[model samples]
Every structure is written in C-alpha cells, then in structure tokens.
Target chain A: MDEPEFIAALRSLPLHPGARNLEDDCALITIGNETLVINHEMMAEGTHFRPDADMADVAWKLVASNISDLAAKGAEPVGVLLGHSLGRDDARFLQGLKEALLAFNVPLLGGDTVTATGASTFAMTAIGRATHHPVPARRGAKLGDAVYVTGTIGRAMLGFEGAAHHRAAFDRPEPRLAEGLALAPLVSAIMDVSDGLLLDCWRMAKLNNQTFAIDPDAVPVADNARRDECMRWGDDYELLFTAAPGAAIPVAASRIGKVVAAGFAPLVLGKNAFPTADNLGYSHG
Target chain B: MDEPEFIAALRSLPLHPGARNLEDDCALITIGNETLVINHEMMAEGTHFRPDADMADVAWKLVASNISDLAAKGAEPVGVLLGHSLGRDDARFLQGLKEALLAFNVPLLGGDTVTATGASTFAMTAIGRATHHPVPARRGAKLGDAVYVTGTIGRAMLGFEGAAHHRAAFDRPEPRLAEGLALAPLVSAIMDVSDGLLLDCWRMAKLNNQTFAIDPDAVPVADNARRDECMRWGDDYELLFTAAPGAAIPVAASRIGKVVAAGFAPLVLGKNAFPTADNLGYSHG
Candidate 1:
C-alpha cells in the first residue's frame, strides 16, 4: 500500500474516541476537567533534511514542528517524550534538543534510545493541556468569516534561497504558541500552516464546506515580485484561522481573505480558481 | 555522544519534576488521582530487524515491547500513538499493527507519518493507568529477599536454533500483564526480563544497592546441553521478582535466587561473580 492507502487502512482500526478519525493535527482526550492535546512527529536524515545538514538544526525543526501542532490547538505544552535511533553527531543533536526545549519551556519526559544503523531517525511526542473549551478545529469556519494569518508567508522558502540572514527562518522556525493560545478564544477555526497557506486554507474550506476567496493584493509575501511563489510555498510555521469580521485579533496578523459559500473549488486565488488543492501546494516528499 | 553520554546530556535539559531523571523504564505522571505510565519505543531496518524480515512480525515486535513495559508497571493498556516513517510494505505493517492492537485491546490514539527515503522506522507511545500504588521499579529489591521468575527462561534462545516449535516464542513473546498485576502487591521488586535473566538481575541488584546470589542448577533453561548459552542469550519476556522467602510465590515461576546486603559484586553466577551488568548480557549495538 502507498501512503494514502496505508492511512486509509489504519482508519479502520480501533481508535480512542479522542482521535477524531485521525483528521485533526492533535488528538483530544479529556482527563478530569482538563483536555489534553497530543501530537507526535518524526524526522529523518534523507527525507526531512540533507545528510550533511546541521544535526542541531534538524533536532530543533523536529521539536518545533510538533509544537506548532499543539499551538494550533491552543494548548500549553506539558512535556515531550523522545525516541532516538543512535548514530553520528549525537552531541550536536542533543545541543539542538536542549535549545528547543529551553526556548519553548517544555519539559523532556523519558523515552527509549536504541542503537541502530543506516539513515538515523528522530521522533517526539508533545503533550499539552488545552486552555480553552471546545478546543479549536479546522472545520469550524463559518460562511462570510474573515481569514487571517500570523506573520508573513514564504520566509522559509526565502531561507532556502541561500541567503545567510534568511537561513534561521528555515532552520529554527518558532511555533506560535502564544498567538494560538490568544486566538483560540476568539477564532472559530484555526490551524498552523505547515503546508502552504493556499493548500491549508483549501483544506480548512473543504472540511468546513466553504470556499476561501483570497485577494492577491491583500495576501502578504516574502518578496512582492514573487507573490504567487510565496503563497504556494510552505514551511513558514504561521497560524491561519477564520474569525467574524471586525472581531478583535489578539496577535499581530494580516487579514488577507474571506470565507465564502461552498463553490466548485475550495480555494479561489484572486479571481481565478485552482483546479485542485493538491496542485497548488508544495510537498517536500 | 554514544548512548550513555547521549542520555546524560538529556539529563541536563529542563524536564518535568516527575520525569525521574530518566531512571524508570516508563515516565510516571499523575493526573488527578490517576497515575499514568508512558513509554515510547522505536525500531528500524537493519539494526532492529533483517531488511528482508517479514514486515508484519517487525510491527508486532514493536507494539509488544512497549506493552511489556506497561505490564512491568502493573498498568493496563489505555491507548497508543504511532509515529511512522513511510517506506515499503506499508500494507503488511498496518496488518500487524491491527493484530497487535486487537490482541492487547489497545486504542490507536493519533500520530504523525512522514515519507522517508531509506531505513523505515516505527515508534509508538503506550499510555496506561496504574492498577497499584507505588508502581514497581527496578530499585525496590531488599536484603534477604527470595528471587523468582514467572514461567521458564531461555525459550526464545531455543527459538533461534531452527526449531519450528520454538520459533513463535522469538517472533511474538507474550507480555506477562496478568501475572504482573497478580504479583504487584506482594512482591518487593518486579521487572520483565527483556535482556538476559542474568543481566536484568544484576541491574536490579545494582539499583537496589544489593547483591543477588542465584543457583545455576535451579535456573530453568531450554535444554541441559545449552544451559550456559541460554542463560546468556536475551529476548526472553518473563517477569523476574523478589519477595519474602515463602510469600505464596503467586505465578508458575521457579524460586532461583536471594537478594543479599550490599556486596562487591551485583550478580553471582553459581559461585563465580560477574562485576558488571553490561558484561553479563547481550548488546545489539
């Protein structure tokens, strides 16, 4: 089976009620009065990074990407359990791990470590406590709602362009934990843009049975001359959500689009509609 | 850093107060009155299994090992979150994953999956609720305690000897969950022997600051001719424990040893003493 087929097969297995059919970024489980949000992510040498990539940065990216999912749920991190395959540059990897844990102020829970050969892999599970009720999901957007995003788009793609000053954006993109927590109480729908804004917006719209109509002039970009490329490229680690018009936004973000009634296309780029969501986004795989 | 150094470096990082400095096999956390046992394990190609090995068994072994950790803690399986790196044989892996979850009665929470180029790796987090107070750890053995192990030892080693009858023992070793729950309240110390019985005994002795004197003649083996080799070989999933001399030895285990006061050696093989735990067992690295 391929990735899609494999995932579909897994959907048939017995799952906890909190799993949400494996559609959401974070799984929700209620223990006592608290709602726990959990996310797990894995990164590898050849697939997620170059063989010669800085081990520290690789570790940082692993932690940040998982944390971003928690941020999308507006959850505060409890700790992370790590599973590591022993290989080269362990010292460098540890350094990067320390930096990310300290930067996010999340504790490191115990996990197993085993020695392995060929193509080292790293995985981590981040557990968090939800700060708001009815914890935000990507399918909660309403018709005629305003669409917004945190910070600018395409910074990671710019970092990939070999600019010395732009490198950290790609190496150590910060998860918007604070903004997510702030936005959770106000927004109807929210998710992080791990994939490109266009693709993620399309996903949110499709799940909500609405259409995201983004204005090319209003959408923020890393470089105005390459606007289309910036909107389509991903890895910016920005929060994207929908709120009622004139609602108070607690974080510094840009209002770039509106949620319209369901249409033939899930996403409309300017006046023209994309044929499919898959055709508009960049996939590292 | 190697495995030991890598673990030491992780100690310096900021962790939750309950992380226990990575001492216990599973991280212990209390949510309200519920004590949670969490463990994550990763298996890979080449190092963990043969590149050509059956993908289904590989997935089975991964889930069983983590479940074994829960069993050691006298905890019932709550659910598991899986982190998988995409590669070949995805269908077989999912089939095995389904079987293991059904066998153990565990729910699949949620996890992340990424496509990777080489060396497919699988990681899982098993969460459970403790059934007994002061959950068992390796550091609870006491002086003059009688040592026992549930079921016979070294059967897995015999499985490696081309015996079709014994092959299943090596392929899918059952975790002693029920036996552990039955023995938890009465035993002074208890642990599942994943490594060789001798090495695990030494580790428990060292952690408790005592010495274990085991009679080689009383120790059960797969065969008399291969007794010595069987005692040294690992992958036997049996519970090893210590209790008051004749405190109704609960399970169908043999009484093989006694825990003594602090001594120069942590383990005594018949009359000869082994200086360190690492020297007595297997090292896959």
Candidate 2:
C-alpha cells in the first residue's frame, strides 16, 4: 500500500476525537483546561535530503518542519521528542538539534535512539499548547474570505537551486509561529505552506468545500521572473490563511485570493482552473 | 556516535524538566491540573526485527513497546501518534495497527507517513495521563525496598526461539497497564523490563544510588532451565518495580530482590556481582 492507501486504512482504526479525521497537520488534545497541539514528522535519508547533505541541516529541517505544523495551529511549543537513527556525523546532528531547540525555544522531552542499517531516518513529535480557542483549521475557510500568505513563496526553491543569497531559506526554513499566533483569532482558516502554495491552497479549499480564486500576480514570490516555479516549488514554511476581506491581519501578509462557494474547481489561478492537484507541488509516495 | 554518546551530547542541549534528565523511559509534562506522560519508541528493520518478520506483528510490537513505557509510569494511555515508513506489506501493517489499537483501547491521534528507501523504520509516540501524584520513577528506589516483577521473564525470549505457546508474548507483548496502575501508589520506583531484568535492575539501582541484591531462585522465569538467559533476554514488557518490604502489594508479582545501599555493584544476582551492565541485556547502539 502507498501513503494515501495506508493513511486511508489508518482512518478505519480507532481514532481520537482530537485527530480531526487525520486531515489536519496537527492533533489537538485537550486535558484539563489546556488543549495541546501535537505533530509528528519523519524525514528519511534519500527521501527528504541528499545522501551527501549535511546532517546538521537535516536535523534542523526535521525540527523546523514539525514546528511549522504546530505553528499552523497557533500553538506555543512545549517540548519535542526525537526518534534518532544513529549514523554518520551524529555529532553534527546533535549540534543542529541543539541549535534548533534553542532557536525555537522548545526543550527536549524524551526520545529513543537506535542503530539501523542503510539510510538513516529521523522522526520528531512536537507538542505545544494552543494559544487560541477553536484552533485554526484548514476546513474552516468561509466563502468570501480573503486568502493570504505570509512571506515570499519561492525563497526555498531559489535556495534549493543553489542560490547563495537564499541558501538559509532552504537549509533553515523559519516557522511562522508568531504570525500564526497573531492571525489565529482572526483567520477563518489556517495552514502551513509546506507542499507548495498552490497545492496547499487547493488542499485548504477542498477541505473547506470552497473554491480559492487566486490572482497569480498577487502572490509574493522570491523570484518574480520564475513566478510559476516559485508557486509550485515547496519547502517555503509560510502561513497560508483566510480571513474577512477587511479584517486587520496584524501580520505582514499578501492577499492573494478570495474563497468562493464550491465552483468549477478547488483552486482557480487567474483564468486557469486547477481541477486536480497533479504537478501542483511536492507529494510523498 | 553511539547511542550513549549521542544521548550524552543531547544532555548538553536544552531539556525540559519533564525529561527526567533523559534517564527515564518517558517524559512528564504537567499542563494545568493534568500531568501527561509521553513516550517515543522506534523500531528499525534488522535492528529491532528480522527482515522477514511479519509486518502485522511489527506494527503490534511497536505500539505495545511504546505503551509499555507509559504503563511503567502508572499512566493511562490517552492516544498514540505513529510515524510510519511505507514499505512491504503495508496492508498487513495497517491490519496489525488496527488490532493493537482495538486491543489496547487507545485511539490513534495523528502521525506522519513517508516513503523511504532501504530498510523501513517505524516510530510511535504514546501519550498518557498520570493516575497518581509523584508518578513512579526509576530513581526512587529506596534502601530496603523489595524489587518485584509482574509476570514471568523469558517468555518473549522463549517465544523468539519458536515456543508456540509463547509466540504471543514476543509478537504481541501486553503492556502491564492495569498492574502498574494498581502498584503505582505503593511502589517506590517502577519501569518496564524491556532491556532485560538484570540490566534494567542495574539501571534502576544505579539511578537511585542503591544496589539491587536479587535472589535468582525467587525470580519467576518461563523456562527455569534457561533462567539465566531469561534474566538477560529483553522485550518482556513486564513491570519491574520496587516497593516497601511487606507492604500491602495489590498485584500478583514475584518479589525477587531487595534495594540496598550503594555497594560494590549496582546489581547482585545471587553470588554474582554485576559491576557493569555489559551483556546483561539488549543495548541499542
């Protein structure tokens, strides 16, 4: 079975009410008066990074990606548990992990370490406390809401292409935690843009049973000349959200689209309707 | 770096107080009036199991092992997040996962599924709510406390050696959740016997600055003829705990030893004094 098939099978199992039907990036678990947001992410060698890539960057990226999921829920990180596979340059991995933990202001909780043959795979479970009630979700995008995205979408794509000036954007993507917190209360829907802006928008619109009418020119792109590639290229950890047209966003973001009632497609870019998500962004098998 | 060195390096990083200095099997995060016990465990192909192992058993074992850690803390499992690597027999894996979830009465929270090359690696994060204040810890064993173990040891070991009657012990080891809950208020210290009874005893003694003087004959083993092997073979998933001598123990467990003051060694099995943990049980690299 593939990822989609396996996930579908997983949905058939006993699921917690907080799972959000496994549709959201993070799980919201309530205990006592606090609601915790938890996210688990895995990065496999050769799948997430090059075999020759720096282990430090791999560790940093793993932590950042998981944190980005928590950010989408406007959660204040509590701690993280790491599942480490011991391999080459483990010291570098530790260094990067320390740096990431310090940078994100999250402490290490507890984890397991093991030795495995072949390519290394690292996993992390990030836990955070929700800062807003009725946590933002991808399925809450209301019709007529303005779609917005924080920061440029193509910096990571440029960096991956060996752009020296944008290298950090790819190696050390910054999670929009602050922005997520600021917009959580105002936004009708929210999610992180990890799987390309257009694809993520399509996912959000589809989840909400709404249509996203996006103006291609309105999206902020790191490289204006390669706008299409920038829009389709993923790894840019930006916040994509929807809010009332004139709502004060309280964060620096560009309004790129408007949510409409279910129409011809989930996503509409100018005159082109993206009836399907094929070739829209990165997808794991 | 090896597991020990890697973990030592991790100690230099920011650690939450709930981490228990990374010496325990689980982290304790107190949110509002609730204290959550969280555990993360990973199993890699070849490292944790044979390549030909059934995917269903592998999935069940993964969930069981993580739940065992939570059980050691006298915590009731809330839910679990899985990090699944898509590979051979994924349908079987999902089947086993569903069975485990149903058997344990624990709901699936959320997780990430990724496509990976080489040997597959699976990870799980089990979260639970503490049932008692001052939750059990490995470092709380006091002098004169009696060391007890629930169920017989070496069952998994026998099962691994193709003992038909013990197959379930190895493939679907039951977490001592109910036993742990009953013993929590009475036990001075507790942990699951995952890394051999002797090695885990040494660990608990070392952590508590005490010594475990065990009576080999008093310990229950699945195969008395291979009692030594049983004590050294890990993956039992039985609860190992220390309680005040002659206390009203509510669980049916074998009292095998007594906690003593720091001495020549951390563990003493009859006439043998184990100064080091080498070869006592499974140690992940």
lDDT of 2 by residue, B65-104 (tens): 9999888899999999999999868988998999999999
**10 residues in a row with least lDDT, candidate 1 chain B:** B276-285
Per-residue lDDT for B1-285 in model 1, tens only? 577777888999987876888877788777787888888888878767788877888888888888988888889888899987777587788888889898888989988787876778889998888888888876678788999987767888888676787787788778888888888788888888887889888888888889999998888887778777777788788888999996996678899999987679989878888777666777654
What is the C-alpha lDDT profile of model 2 across A3-22, one tens digit per residue? 77788888999999999899
Q: Which residue pairs show collisions in model 2?
A: none
Q: What TM-score would each prediction reach against the true structure?
A: 0.96, 0.99
Candidate 2 second chain TM: 0.99
| Candidate 1 residue spans exceeding 4 A from truth | none
**For model 1, what TM-score is found for chain B?**
0.95
Best by TM-score: 2
